[model samples]
Target: MLAVNYTTLRENMKTYMDKITDDYETVIVTRKDNKNVVMLSEEAYNNIMENIHVLGNKSNYDWLMESKAQLENGMASAHELSEAETDE
Candidate 1:
């Protein structure tokens, strides 16, 4: 994560954008008067949206938590995905 003032960001927009895209770093751009905004790579944004989609649903949240508990309790084991799925 990185924080940069809006002025600095404007002055070095390309550098900041490069860092965000290549390094997958989240940036907080602070404006005057305490206003702020965030910048993230498309991949990061999609991943976050996907997680929100799953965790935002009640049944999905419950199932995920239950599976996590089972794994922690030694009731579940991890397995490799099939080649076809991994190709994605």
Candidate 2:
């Protein structure tokens, strides 16, 4: 992790961002007025958000596959679709 003041960020934004993404796992830019105000590495931030989505899904691929297998075996619950047959 790298800790840089916001002023330093304003002065060399691109170089700092590039260095963090290419070589460091994290970078923080602190503000003088706010002790902890900062900027985080865009790549690492994005990766963290993506994992949240994946982990938050309660019933994912394995559950879907089990449901499919049950349906194929005629063991899943059902309601007659007589309306669709009547429409035909």
TM-score of each: 0.83, 0.50
Q: Which ten residues in a row have the lowest lDDT in candidate 2?
A: 79-88
Model 1 stretches with alpha carbons more than 4 Å out: 78-88
Per-residue lDDT of 22-86 in model 1, one digit per residue for the tens? 99999999988888999999999999999999999999999999999998999976788876555
Q: Backbone collision count in every prediction?
A: 0, 0
TM-score, predicted candidate 2 vs. hidden true structure: 0.50
lDDT score for candidate 1 against the true structure:
0.94
TM accuracy, model 1? 0.83
